[model samples]
Target chain A: MTWQPELDELRAREAEARKLGGADKIARQHAGGRLTVRERIEGVVDPGSFHEVGAIAGQAEYAPDGTLKRLTPSNCVMGRAQVDGRPVVVVGDDFTVRGGSADATIREKPIMAERMAHDLRLPIIRIIEGSGGGGSVKTIETTGRANLPGGVGGTQLYHYTGANLSVVPVVGLGLGSVAGLGAARLAASHYSVMTKETSAMFVAGPPVVKRLGEDLTKQELGGWEIQTKAGAVDHAVESEAEAFDCARRFLSYLPASVHALPPVTTPTDDPARREEKLFTHIPRDRRRVYQMRPIINAVVDQGSFFEMGRMFGRSIITGLARLNGKPVALMASDPFFYGGSWTADACAKIIRFVDLAETFHLPVVYLQDCPGFMVGLAAEKAATIRLGVRAMAAVNQTTVPWCTMIIRNAFGVAGVVHQPANRYSPRYAWLSARWGSLPLEGGIEAAYAADMAEAEDPAAKLAEIEERLNRLRSPFRTAEAFWVEEIIDPRDTRRLLCEFADLAWPLLTPAPSGLRMRP
Target chain B: MAESPITIRAEIGASVWKILATPGAAVGEEEPILILESMKMEIPVVAPHDGVVVEILVAEGQQVEEGQAVATFRR
Candidate 1:
């Protein structure tokens, strides 16, 4: 028997599903300056590469004669797609379909999307909008009952979130207003991006909050400024297009999953390439503060730094960068903020950054210049020391090869946290590295407080004490004691980091598989 | 309504390293008024909002204490 008529019926159903939420809803989505879910999926993944798994799983109707009438497709459109030629699982929420709310799609759809990535050990990208296919008040009216949460998809969601973190890189992009489950999906990612204007992530929307008599706009409540600063979101861009670009760039550095090492492109930038500005950016004066970003740019492959948690912890700059086209996590102290001191937030930022490196099996390169956990009553109140020690635990947990370069002030406990303490870090280099239990500027005053008070001239005694202590605090003296390993020129940073990457990858490949990428 | 001048204060005790914005230069929120060197660390005195620098109260090499005015911006 010929199957042409049945094939024609399948073609018709596919076309209806492709129509998404129909013209009116599509127009409304566009009026809000938002791309439809299908458009977002196309924009994020490689063109024409999305081979959808469940294209017709939504509401359907039939005529009295059983002739097909209409179909409203499910909000979650997920399947295998290539991101920059690497295979990945892409899950896009169609906001036009009841705002991707829980009423529009079965719980199994999005959960299946997450589970597909987990079982296959593939990188998963979630294009989230409108509560992440979560709750809708309309459900109560439709179902004739208001049901409690936790009975549906909760265990699978948890398992996928944790499994995805350990086994593969999960990316979440907020292209529109997201709340409840939507916000949870975005926050669960290794990297998350949100569009500044069209997207906001919150527990509930404005109308829902009106019940409490609170007046707030979505932007005011959970916009880029609030979510990013809270560290709930990793990056925010000016537009959805920028968010897509960020997701693509983020996945480019990671391997398909944690079972293999990250992909390395053929080196175009010379491994020995060095910039002279590294010397200029690092000021010669001991008391002066110089820009650190320029130095970070100069050392890594040109334009390779993809910074994370920039707004939350300004003092410490953490990002993924490539050394000779080999993926690596790069952490640098930004002297511009907090003199690169490890504030409570900065320490938390460290915990997350190191976790990303270890989970993804990327080598870590630290450009350390921290004085210590910040000193003050405010610092103590913030529990900076407690968070700082937690950061040390995260650093110690890093099984991947670590290379630390003491750019300047490596003083106190925070200084020692630069490299994993469990093993002899493969390469610990110093460029004008200065280290001590505490800075001589503030330490001498406490030790010699009595002597200075008793001196004939307090100012002269203070100066004498400082001069004596400063001589002893030199990095050269430490090197002579074999406390530090190498003191290299600033220009040699790129070559050294490339060497470290070269050393790291081989050790990584032969290791056991089936471990989770610790988020 | 006429704009008022907002003084940018030093949050930490420091000696001014560089005057980042000259008088009359437009500045945005969190933009540095000047780079301050203190305890061998560089701290920036940030502007509170979009404004034009009306005056620089602290000069290069001048020591400033916490709460000392570093610059005045017309907002």
Candidate 2:
């Protein structure tokens, strides 16, 4: 191919367009421990594959003397690219120019990116930083009037987030201070991530909060720790690279958009491979706590568990794991915290995780060791019952294949709720299943009061009652009644779950028509 | 012959306020090892049996009924 003059001219134009803020601004952005908007897009997409849209479209200013005053285009960038060869549309906020304020959000920038993704059936990754299309104070000054709510280009951002929940996978990366509409953008995505040191998300920054008479640092208001632990953001990473990597990993388990099924990879582990360690993972002493993470790792693929909302619900762990190379939603009770008692916060987390799994057509794998719901004045005040019922309802409504393994301590009504309803109940198994109305320690004293009082030594009499009840509470008693399907050895969990994965694989061939929106 | 032990029903029916001992907090027979509050009054939950506290069923601020075992001791 010969180098034509028009082709060379166009190349120069593209280079000029990229140098929007000049070299000084670009270097300053690098010096401040931040990536330029274009650099971030490059970091997320496969190298040299991004085909940018609307590069030449920007604002043109004229002076009173009929000469050019300044040239400023849209303070946002939009393009199409591939992540690991999977096509996706990307939108980034150019913060170096006008702080990416809403006034500079050109009409076609958001619409082009959103509509293209929607029409082309591709996932959209939005690299949002700064105000991210929110109206700034200077905008009102420049326009000589306040922009009406939902006015021109007002609902564009809303439509972008709304489409993600319904038709496509939207991932938001919080790389800087995300406030107002920016924070909403971060939350509205299916998966969101933030850099621990550099990113913060809040309804309003410290300036607005300070004016309201409360002094707070930006980190105190909405740092990565606060957001991730509060369930505002799904994951937090130590670096921007890790945040991007997290987003890529999350999308791997989900479809490019809502209309497709998640891609399946070949299984590397044998379906019948069993790890004997699970048999003794739970301690014989009920009061002692054991680490639940290892049990989760042992059951899933050797190194395939990717946890979400980990810190928020300390009592429950939710994540994505591959069983025989098939993606499954993994939920487990963390016995270390509050004795694995589900609290109001933990209930909310369960509901959210279940909804996501059901909507995405992912089968659920529950490693249950729940003692039941947390009870107290604090629980009641927090409306634990209402939240608990909602969690139960979410689990009940899910149509996906579910498999529950009772590791230990399935007691009380909350424990019963872990199993699905009788008709569409999941394939249930018990590994040392121990179920009852309550633990015997508390029940023995009340039931045997008369017998204890009549004995010569009341204290000694109570001990005899406890000893008898302990014998009755054994898992062998429950197994004799056939209450649980089978009491397999702990090491058999991996093999059993892999078998369930094979059984459930036939169900994933067809996409469900009515995909529930994640709650 | 043994005298009948008094049945100590909770004066305030509520969840556990706080469990003061593990399975083995040395407690005098009449000493309060746990506290339960219901309505508005702070109800002192006392040791029903004297010995080494063998098992504490509930943790701090756990819910308990009028006659729930907050702890068990070997006399």
Candidate 3:
């Protein structure tokens, strides 16, 4: 009388989908020592907080009596879940079912997951194991159809991928071999994590690429090593548990969505705790190189400087660090590496890192110690100037609050990328700062190359030329012109940065920016 | 577990101004292990981690080329 039979039928179909390609496939997944889709969600989010939707959207087989038969679930399982008590939409790949391919590609599952994150104004976590919502060559055979690449309403995914960059934090966790659309989703994220032991992300799998005759495993081709170095992925971990922990930690620094201000933790380190070592840390001697890392550590909140892509761009250091426990994106030039010059790789790193800071509304703190763009035949061949200009464009486009502390040697075009162009920096300060068309040594050598060649005592003439130019290159001379804003005691940097953070807080937009952010 | 060694290298051609680390001495990450004077600038070869100095390869006043090993740290 109550239609209990139909309700029971609904339960039966859900149970079938939950089995995930039946006992055989689930066993294989376990044999691989991997968690299923539901398990990943369980491990990633709070206990018993997962409220799933579209659970039985897979194709169904019916019996003669019209009762439900075996079912195949859509490989994508999307739902609302709580990660550390805040709501986030979790879209996972159920690899046990059709290898997490779009065999029963109910396209709405992924689109809805994305739309849910945007509509609900919550952060989205993608647990991508395979091409769950992605395409494959075999899709033409499976669905008996073919289509153009990212064409015809591909704009749907584009809207979220671009919009969410400024609207909400999108985190991607690549846990297995990810291809096609899977690779796109991973790269689209503001932050990405991969499991070193199991995860691989690429446009196509090794088999499709076998024609090249490169016998490489999935990891060898697109593992964390390759992707992270390429700046396609942000972080890597030894296990899925560690990856989840990183995701949670990263979210803790950001708001659930851009509609809210980024969370600010109470400072455990004193805002006015002057690092006395800094007094002598950056030696007054212009020719000596001191480690930039120590000065950074001293100024930032203890244990809060989380560096990103350290090895890829050695000259420029980019990371998220807390000043007075307020998160800020920090970029500093390391004097030891190429004299803190910007190379093509460093320029690319800047583009990505600045995009990250702008998308998430983090104020940028640039420790500008650049000696300028890398020069010589190598630099020209690498298109250093072209990419440096592109980097300048990225900096110019960023609307975030930026403060630059010119430490030393801000010489050429690369130095200008420290802050937004055509605008006064909110709080631009200098410490042991030096700036000009070029450093005295290099400038003199190049400009007086002919003069030195013509002089009989070339060495003496060069020395005299450098002595005459040296006075103009002094940082104090630039300050006298009022070109530089302020020269402060190095020890006071921590206090000043804290003040700037508080000052910049009110300027941050408390809602999704009206515009969009592209990767 | 034994602390793996991290080698400290000279990033530019310079004459070693001073040796800041001694065997078994405690050092903080980014603290200078040695100072190299080049281009009229003083550059510090710093430790990469909180560790004890394990060995010193170059002596004070020694000339070292770029990427030359200067010291090692057990971190």
Candidate 4:
């Protein structure tokens, strides 16, 4: 009369599900230098904090007497887990189970994970691998039907997957050969990472691609090097443990969802501290390039800057950092690349980054040194100006509090778009700052071309004109006319930036940014 | 481990301004191998690792395209 026998049977089924694809398949997975889905979940989340939702929802074979004979668990292992003690919906592809193909999947489980993240207002972290519930040719034989795409999950799965972008922070990690839906899932995220040795992401794997006349290995087809360099993924890590650490660190700055402001940590570094190097960081000779990262590190909370999309956009650097323990979006110019002129790829990066900032309600701080949109035929072919205008629109439309520090060059339309017009945005400039429609070196030749051509000594006239403009070009003259904002000593940058962060903290709201984010 | 020859390429199209490292010269990671002038700014092309420069493929005042090999080294 006791229900203990049924309880025992339930426990047995749960244990059977935990075995994943069994010992031999799991061994093969291990031999490939990749962790199983369960191991990945354990490595990423708090120890023993995983609360699984569906442990035994899979195909089960029945005995002749109506007793359960075998249970093959679903390939999608999803549950709620604590990352840095914050609850998140973690969905991982169990690649050991039939390469995590559609034949081995229970689509509802992944759909439920997405719904949980969206409804609960929690972050979603996808530990992606294999085909990510995408179909296999064997599925046609198994079902005896060629199923239409988006039919199995009823489109709600795709809806929630895309909807989660505006509602919560989504992080995708490519831990192995992620194809089809897995690639889409990885690309559609606030942040994404892939392992250098183990991960490859593409719409399809090599076998299908080979029929298109391109024979290549998975690594050659869609390796981390190819994706990260192309900006298809944000980061490429050396190991799974490093990827987990990156995920934890990235989440540490943001709130659980867009319904909350970013988490503020207790300040460890002194806000008033100023580095002496800032004074001499920019060379007096404006033609020489300098490292912008060191300046960023010195101004933000020490070691808090997390850079993204480093390989794709060489001119503009985008990242997140803390100012006096308050998280903020950071944009700076890397003068080493095209003299910090915005390229087509850099412009695209800007749009995505500004959208992320607006979505999360994080205030933005730009260290400006833009010369202009890139020129030359390559730039035209890539539609740099068109993308640049879109970048300008993205910046102009943001409602977040903004602060701009003109460290050096700020010329042309690209330079003027540093902050939105008709807003109470605070702008600071260093003594070395320079701003104009164009630099004197290039402007004089263009503007005074007729005057120079008419002169007996054109070269001398050009130099004389340049010298006269150069004398008037001192940033003090601009400050005197109030054309530029306050020009302060470089050593005071961190102090002023910290003050801006303190001011911006109160202005941030937990409401969603009404505009749709472009992933 | 045996050192292999690694080619360092120009990241942007620019005229070579200064050759900072010569063949057989030892350099550290991120140490400038040369400087290229573009858009009125001097951009540095740096060593990929601690290595000895095997050759300088581009000369001063020469215009090099992006992705063109500028130097080679063995780490």
lDDT values, one for every candidate: 0.83, 0.76, 0.81, 0.90
Which tens-of-lDDT digit does each residue in A1-519 have in candidate 2?
A: 677976775665566668766678778777767788888999998999899998867776678996544556576888899998899999988777776666777856877798888778788888888886547888778989987766776686577666556667788899888888778878887778988888889989999999999899989999987898788888888888887788788878877765677777888877777777776776675655567899898878878899988877677999898998889999998865566778888898898888777777788999888877877677799898899998888888877788888887787767877766744544445555677786665566677778877899987878887787778867777668876667777777788898888788787644543654652
- What docking class should model 4 receive? high
- Using lDDT, give the best candidate's number: 4
Worst 10 residues of 3 chain A by lDDT: A510-519
> Which candidate model has the greater lDDT, 1 or 4?
4
For residues A406-454, what per-residue lDDT tens digits would candidate 3 score against the true structure?
A: 8777777887677898676754555677777777676787888899899
Which regions of candidate 3 deviate over 4 angstroms?
Answer: A1-6, A150-155, A283-290, A427-431, A511-515, B1-75
Can you tell me the DockQ of model 2? 0.03
What candidate 1 gets wrong by more than 4 Å, as runs, is A152-154, A210-213, A428-431, A510-519, B1-32, B36-40, B45-52, B55-75
Candidates' TM-scores? 0.90, 0.82, 0.85, 0.97
Give the least accurate 10-residue stretch of model 4 chain A, judged by summed lDDT.
Answer: A152-161
- lDDT, model 2, position A159: 75
Top TM-score prediction, candidate number: 4
